[model samples]
Target chain A: MKPIELTEAQVKSRRSRNIAIALICVGLVVMFYLITIVKLGPSILNRAL
Target chain B: MSVINDHDPVTEIYISSAMPGDFFALLKPRVMSLVVFTALVGMMAAPGEIDPVLGVIAILCIAIGAGASGALNMWYDADIDAVMSRTKSRPIPSGAISKSEALGFGLILSAFSVAILGLAVNWFAAGLLAFTIFFYAVIYSMWLKRATPQNIVIGGAAGAFPPMIGWAVVTGGVSLESVILFAIIFIWTPPHFWALALFKSDDYKLAEIPMLPIVAGEASTKKQILAYSILLAPLGVAPWLLGFASIAYGVIATVFGAAFLWFAWRVYKMDEADRKMLPAKKMFGFSILYLFVLYAALLVESLLPKLLNLIGIA
Candidate 1:
């Protein structure tokens, strides 16, 4: 099968969108981790079976 | 080596050339900022302490939820937006983003914001945020906007929910104080939007939107604006009356509210031949300032003592 060619503008926009999504994902990860720590505090290490 | 079918229709594929800024524009950043400010005041006014990080998360979620609704509203209103001069340059109307993409973006963000708020904060606040999105996207944008002259009156509830949601973020419940905050914005909406509709009536008429000025004549719309301004004046001072804000805020609210009335009265007395609609325009500008100053005063009042004690200044 032949590949579908993308224009430079399209490729550039896609790259920027991907980078934005990646940054947002990283931010969300850090936020979730901080929230977990804030909510649980040192008790996060005291999980019961 | 197969025979070509000449009768088959050609299908077009869409590739997004939208930048991150376009997507951000879809969020309606100006409106989101107002939501953030009001919600922050609500959080500060509520009687409790919250972890700084969690408080930030709550505000972020509420802002995202508000933006999600804006995206959905733009998606649904793209047709009217394209016709209206004021909104013709919006992301969807400008062809920077497609309707389906906006819908997808709104839905995903709505779910994520609600889920994150519920997990990170209290469920009550998340529920309020979810209701706000639903009210704006479905109830206001889809149903009320094109249907009635009273649209902004009922639809204004969506905008007023942010403070209550903010109060819930810290307090885990609602109170008379939060409800008063909600009422101030709710009553303020009619006069604020009617002023814009007075000058922009031609836009609404062209777009076939049933704004007050387009549906009810300008004279009747002016009367309604005046009446709402009268109601809004005292409602703006309720935070002080309820003992939530100090006398300084009371004085500020009274002064701003009276100025709001003066502008509304000017709009009421404006001549039919006055093509400038200057009074209406001034009223719109002053109304925004009124809300911002009132909320900023409340926020400072709530935080000042704590801040002073923190620095040993009190």
Candidate 2:
């Protein structure tokens, strides 16, 4: 069995795409956090103990 | 990779060379910018208070939804796009991204945008956003584009939805004011696209798409452009007339709307033998400016009072 090999250009492009995906994932997490805070407001902290 | 058995010979291993920029291009950034601007105006003009954060989220979702539709359009229109010179360099047409990839991207974004908008803003706006994506992707790109010369006329509804969606984000329902905003864009689209069609009739002809100029001839297209411009002129000023916008906006809309009509009339009077198509070209340029100026005026009118109040000067 032989292992598949990627060209340098392919590797670079794949890396860049992975980084972009990572950044988007991070951004979405931040966005969801902000949305939760905005929607819940101070009342979120005032919930029953 | 495993060595192929003797029975099955190995062909070629597909390695994607597609960069992130190629995928970004699939979103049609120019169209997304217009969607963002119009939706922002809609949000601002609505008579309700919205948290700035929520408003930003709503705009982001709408823009993403619009981008998704653009990706779907690109995926479906790749073949014709390859034929048309203006669109030949698009990601799909240029082979930077595969059609299936584009379709998957569009579908994923569409779902995310609609769902997030629903959860964050309100269901009504989300529903409108979903319908807009469906209209652009399925109704316009797949059906109307190939089947009829009136594609842009009816399909313009998809573009007109953003402002209404924005308004919905604040009001949670449609109103006369929002409908007027929708009408302005709806009426403005035909003249804008037809002006481009007049200059690029050959491209539409080559792609076998039934644009008005390609199917109904330039004379009829010009008449239709002028007719739409006439309708749009009053409609652009309707917000002012209806008392939503101030007199300043009214005056701005009236002046810009008149200019739009003037450009359309110039296009209408352009001679068939005029090889330069200068009038049509200028109309196309002015049409974009006209819509932008009208929307920008509305946006400024909506935001200025708020800014003034914040500065303790209102």
Candidate 3:
């Protein structure tokens, strides 16, 4: 019947967890970029024709 | 929400106020870490090269799939989990999340992981991910877990498939080397869990899960643990013998495998009156380290050559 309110500790824990997930997602994006560079090299941007 | 008669199911509560941590807990992060590590080692060990992006994508899918299975397992085992002391504080049992919500979360992640993997990588790896999820969630959790003492023995396959799937991501198919990796984990699992079961027999008894120690008794369980450890010893070194790993890895595997057996032997020789189950507890702790160190060795074996080549040392 009423909106559920999170305790202060619960809110703090939730914030930290969301931040951790966000950081991991960012790390994955950075890794993908580095991997693309290592894999493709200078030839990546070259015209095939 | 409404209350029901004692015989009827609890009225379905639609409270969706679950915290972020609760949802993450549903993913079983500890188990997902092992799946990710093994799958990474598998991909690295494969002979051919894979696009770095594709490799990362595959690993992500594998991790998510593992988490999906974990959530589903929690959903199905919630009742027993509530009864078991070790699992009584889990997200569902602790009321951090509801069963229906967990089921929905697991199914969505399962489908998402498989579909993304298929589209971004090869279909074979995707299929393996799907099967692994299904095996753990359906075959293992829903059926085998409650049906017999051999539940973990067969259900362990669900855990073992990650490395093979990792190999498939790179090689596009299975091979002797990948199968060997699968076998090592497969063989390692029984002794590992049975050691835990030895100490946690009361939990299994209370939950009525029919674990080997409960069904076949402690002495029999200890003997089986030793037998499996003996089998695991040689199998751990198979990658080195098969020429994929270096002599150094072979030596490490041999030493770890031997130590694993020594622990198993200790567990077997432990007295029944030894209610502390010190040997079984020791074996259980060491088993986690054993797998971690062995996989770390394999990962080094896969990476060392490249590192040496980069430095012009080999």
Candidate 4:
């Protein structure tokens, strides 16, 4: 098997993605409890109609 | 204290093996049943028709999302789980699954549940499912949980989402009826959970979980439980008065609400040393029965009209 290596930047990037995922989960509960809607935004068809 | 001794020769490592227990635990099966039952009520009682297939898909996605949340909770709380006798046997704590593995599994399932619901059902329902998982795993886990005694008060939003998700699946939008359903759970959660917190005060304190009873003491917790119960009883009857449900539901709600208040009153009046485990213990046991019966009544009342219509008997 080949030795696996990741540069410092790559490791940092991976960790950043993990943090984003964690934050997204946290945001969900906060949004619900606050009753805030981060609208997915209106669709093009809905705008046209 | 370790649920699994890491250095023991017989100690197991769950490298990649899958067990039935892991999957069941992930589904948060007990929680899922309540979610499914409430979701069914929301869908059935909604004004318009959702195709049976779409409705089924929506509920399935919600169930999967709930499980994903459960898995993430187990992954993060593994250390605390090991210390709490009540949670020590969980898959993560018991060494049947590694924390990293559980986290990855949860992330994958959350993504899958959301994506499938979006594609097969609608973006609205899918979005709700995605949010529910995030709320339970992240907000309830990393944010409010350790940070505040009001953890469950805010975290109960996770439990409240199923009705909205169910409603969105059918209506593809939000409405008053679903909001009422949401409110019922929101109010119910504090009392229901605080009752447990009442008896599990030491466990919470030891785990540093910041449960209200642990931080505030029994009398204050009992008072809070009663206050929430007061809010809950009226809120429980709101669905019927607001026209989301019928008199049948209203009557049942009134009866259960009265009994719930009585139980909470019993809890509030008892002194800590005057009884067995404490007033909180009795309140805790009755509260579970109260929620189950209340939701079951909601399901029955919502379904009765349709069941009657189907047979041409109404």
What DockQ values do the models have?
0.48, 0.55, 0.14, 0.03
Which portions of model 2 miss their true places by more than 4 Å? B1-13
lDDT score for residue B226 of model 3: 97
Model 1 local distance difference test score: 0.94
The per-prediction i-RMS, to one decimal, reads 7.4, 3.4, 8.3, 13.9
Query: Which structure among the candidates has the greatest DockQ?
Result: 2
Q: Clashing residue pairs, candidate 2?
A: A4-B1
Please provide, for model 3 over B41-123, each residue's C-alpha lDDT reduced to its tens digit, 9 standing for 90 to 100: 99999998887777888899999999999999999999999999999999999988889989998999899889878877789
Tell me the TM-score that candidate 4 gets on chain A alone. Answer: 0.53
- As for TM-score, the candidate ahead, 1 or 3, is 1
Model 2 chain B: which ten-residue window has the lowest total lDDT? B1-10
What tens digits encode model 4's per-residue C-alpha lDDT throughout B1-314? 12444454432432234454565675568888888877777777677776565576677778878888988998888889888888888887787667887888899889988987787667998888888888989999978999999999999999998888888887899998889888888889998888777767778888889898777878898899889999999999998899877788888889989998998898888777753656667777777777777777777776777789989999
Query: Which candidate tops lDDT?
Result: 1
Q: What is the TM-score of each candidate against the true structure?
A: 0.96, 0.96, 0.86, 0.80
Given candidate 4, what's the lDDT at residue B125?
84
User: Candidate 1: TM of chain A?
Assistant: 0.88
A best-first ranking of the candidates according to their lDDT comes to 1, 2, 3, 4
Q: Distance from true position, residue B26, model 3, in Å?
A: 0.5
Tens-digit per-residue lDDT, A1-49, candidate 2: 4455677987899899999999999989999999999999888899778
Q: Candidate 4, residue B150: CA error in Å?
A: 0.4
Q: Model 3: runs farther than 4 Å from truth? A: A1-49, B1-13, B311-314
Candidate 2 at B14: error in angstroms? 3.1
